[model samples]
Target chain A: MLVFHTALMRPPVIDNLQYAKFSPRIFEEMRAGGVDAVHVTVAYHESFREMVLNLEQWNRWFEDHPDLIFRGTCAEDVLRAQQSGRTAIFFGFQNPSPIEDDIGLVEICHQLGVRFMQLTYNNQSLLATGCYEAEDTGLTRMGREVVAEMNRVGMVVDMSHSAERSTLEAIEHSTRPIAITHANPAWWHEALRNKSDTVLRALTEAGGMLGFSIYPHHLRGGSACTLDAFCAMIGEAAQRYGARHLGLGSDLCQDQPDSVVEWMRVGRWTKRIDYGEGSAAAPGFPPMPTWFAGNRDFGVIRQGLLAQGLSEAEVDGLMGGNWHRFYAESFGPA
Target chain B: MLVFHTALMRPPVIDNLQYAKFSPRIFEEMRAGGVDAVHVTVAYHESFREMVLNLEQWNRWFEDHPDLIFRGTCAEDVLRAQQSGRTAIFFGFQNPSPIEDDIGLVEICHQLGVRFMQLTYNNQSLLATGCYEAEDTGLTRMGREVVAEMNRVGMVVDMSHSAERSTLEAIEHSTRPIAITHANPAWWHEALRNKSDTVLRALTEAGGMLGFSIYPHHLRGGSACTLDAFCAMIGEAAQRYGARHLGLGSDLCQDQPDSVVEWMRVGRWTKRIDYGEGSAAAPGFPPMPTWFAGNRDFGVIRQGLLAQGLSEAEVDGLMGGNWHRFYAESFGPA
Candidate 1:
């Protein structure tokens, strides 16, 4: 049977206070986690140019570390990466800022090996509204046009951070299946990051894929989430929307410091990164549980899945099979 | 019963020479023709700016000679012009050159009271393919976007000068009904200015209106066309797509000179104007037919319709009822 790990994050804490510093030990932990592939985002930076530069740097790093890093543009690449015993790193854009106002830039980025593109991150852009926006107006005039263009160009629109109205409009406008690459079920958690059950059902009915994120804040147990509990959450989603439609997306932020965490909390770059005592803790869930233990790694989570009742097949499907299938259906011939 | 002529062109030639020179005789003939409203184009010879200036000049001219000309932007305007015993002159553009690349300019022209705007004018533009273009690639990316925008903003998209592909694409993209506004039947005479029967059927199916033109070049007989011949052509189209879908677009060039005719034929402007020939011709029809002795004006055409076995209801539908309905559906209260 094909064995793949679905959600594996290199760093466990992204919006933490100590985001400025890099940790080489985190990379080693990811390698030991046996994660076949991972979706890495390089978009939500200061500007489009900066995002390009950061992606170029990531590309070079992947090139240097042949054993640890491999770029995956599609499902085939992920499969090949697993066969070759290398971690497939799929490039993603958390927001449409990199595209700016040009609709043609979508094709350009697809050519540049950025596989998954989200219309909006955590704010409104030219394309669509983000989840954080209070007014969830449907797609703008330009936004509808952009959706058609994206469909024509064969790009998978990720609605992980999109506003409700904009998300529904995208779901309606898209001819191909859309993906919520990393989100929780609002039915269970009631978090803004979680999707309502109605929206979730509609998404699956429209031939879309859902990625249940293992973020403690969105789960019933916040930082105290264990591998078994996370698996149970995913299993519930699988039962709700067939196992074929479900996948894992561990929104792990490992190396980031308290400053980065604070920056994310304020929701803008100019604002100070907040890492206060109680503020850092997620509601319901304990303070961000380090991956599985004190270590911010995927190996612990992999072992934790084994500790649960998940068979190897179910674990593999949860790990990456569903994501692989989704990628293949979305981006043809790649 | 309400009666109006569907098409009336101030003959293109008198005694086999281009009617480049304007004569007072033509104005007298128009008065005799009982023409209540004429779709007059100003973009053919001048740039967009020049077209605006020319229309302003004409507006002032109409103000000075209240008995001769009346500005008509709507069905009510036409009705008022007729009730007031003046010839209602509806301003139109044969080509979209005046607005150039700025889409916002469309709204400006709308504000300035341009009632009809064609996508192309016998040549390719930023928005669409013209009939004369070697390849009719349909609406360009911007063109498709513009069509949707036009529909949303409520601009009548005239396709008289547009290529077949561009016309079809516009029809599909526009949620509101489109108007050919001026063209003969390619089936009657396979002229580029004429539309194919398939396109006509599609237009009618979409609740769009077709405004047949009286340009003799598009007719089989060319300069030999008489008032009876024009009615016969209209009768054939009425048979093909019932009387309700048909309307009159006189394409009447009552005052343009021979130099303007030659400039239009060459598809370029001389030192007298800054634009091309395509813009000079009225949208949806061939160059204006030269004046002739036996040819009657708009009023005579109305009488001719009576002689063509059309009942009062059918004649009214063909003359102006259809246009009134189209304008109401397209512009709403405006």
Candidate 2:
């Protein structure tokens, strides 16, 4: 049985809209949770040099934790790591900030095993505007060039945090497929982070994939979220976008601090939505737990799928098979 | 029966790109050309206030030449002016530099009866990057918002000097369609001002229109161009893009001083392409001719179409019907 955890987070730089902290223990927790691999992001509000330095740090960390963190550049690598009883860490970036204004950097990052790059974080960058931006200007001229370069270099352009126009423009401009590495549906949440039906259809029509997120702030009702509630959200998305194109992008900000949250709140990083500030934090959701707490464990997520009466095959697809297929198609052979 | 001269240009600003000195006689020349209505572009490289001032000057000019220069805003106005034996002067700006960074100014300009605005000139602005820019970053964040606002305010978004990405992004993002306004396809000549075939197709698909430019430098073999040669370029474009979406946008720079050309050559207002130290000029082209000489005479262009063996309807479409449809759809009523 190919059992893989689709949405696992190895936090240190993962900054949720509300909080940011570093938790080194999450990797161990993921292992205990039966997680085989996780897509780990590198770029986030960092300069080009800082991104390179962080990539170096990640490379060194993989070397230090050979049994724990095996770098997975492709689906085959993930399978191989799982077979060897090691956790596969696929390199990704939540934002294209590291690439900055130079489009050629996309090819460099792709060559360096950075397989997934979200077009924006929570705001506008040189490439694309994030969902939080008051306007979704789609792809910049450099952004269109970046999409072409990514296609040529085989890097996956992620649109988890992108504006609607940016997403549509990217879909139209890209010769290769794309992915929404983590997002919810606006039909359920009406949040900026949620994908609209038009956008979702456009993504799938372009042979892309979607990673339904588990962030509480993007849920319909503020916080008070349980694993079952998260599964219900995924169920609704699955019905609309189909389970085949759906996977989990747990958006788990494992270990981040309060200062990072402040940085996200105020900064000219991207324009803000007109719906008032600090709406990013779910009203009743407690501060993010150290790891997956309460009924938030992966097993609980599986149980929730059972509660939905989904078949074993469907469950398998949502859990990891779909993501594996997506990675293989997008990233090519190991 | 409803004949309109679609490619007519007002005399003053034309001198800037034409390298000919501005003179009062230029307006008489335009009237003698049988141009019933001319798109009078305000200054290209002027500040917002300067553009406003130019408009004021043109308004006064119309007041002075009551029988010759009538203010034209809609197709009906053009017809009315034509019936009254007057040259309808449709006020437009080659670039939105006059709007500066404020989105509200789009409405302000529209209210002031300015109909057309290219997002950028020969450089990057708050809205978009121009074709001449070394790095065509396309529409900036502000550019996307501006497009929506333009759609809302019923203003035409022209991409005459826009970067390829910016052009495509504008076409995709615009709700009420858009126009190339003035550009040649790179297929005819690999000039910076020429759009790619992909771009042309994208614009047509979005129900937008293309305004084929007859600037000699942008045509193959430059200054050696004749009406027949220019028509051949249009014929090829018409074959690919269909005549319904094609209209003439002769970039006739009639009465401009040599200093403006020098400024354009140095890219003083915009950055130069990377391969070249200076702005990309029309290759192998001689110095820009005086206004009427730079463009084929409307009558000669019609003769050229007939000589090219085009049907009467095709010639009519190329001459003005296409442009009439575009204006009617874009500007609405009169």
Total backbone clashes of candidate 2, pairs 3 or more residues apart or in separate chains: 16
What's the distance in Å from true for residue A202, model 1? 1.5
TM-score of every candidate relative to the true structure: 0.45, 0.45
Q: Is the docking of candidate 1 incorrect, acceptable, medium or high quality?
A: incorrect
lDDT per residue as tens, model 1, B115-188: 66788878788889988778999988878776766675567888987889888888888888888887878988
What is candidate 1's lDDT per residue for A1-334, written digit by digit as tens? 3333445422111110111122346444555656666777766643554565665566556646867666667666665665566666776777777777766556555645676778887677788888877888878888887677667556788888888888888999888888888888887777777898877887888888887676566676677766677766676777788766767666665555544554444445446444321243531223456554322355555466556666666655555666776776777521
Query: What is candidate 2's lDDT per residue for A1-334, written digit by digit as tens?
Result: 4334445522111111111231335656656666666787776777655665566566556646766666677777666755666657777787787776766556546645788888887778788898777887788888888788787667888888788999999988888888887777787778778889999999987878887666556655545566666778778767777787777777665455544445444444446522222445532223432234521266666778878877767777777777777776777521
Clashes of 1: 43
**DockQ, prediction 1:** 0.01
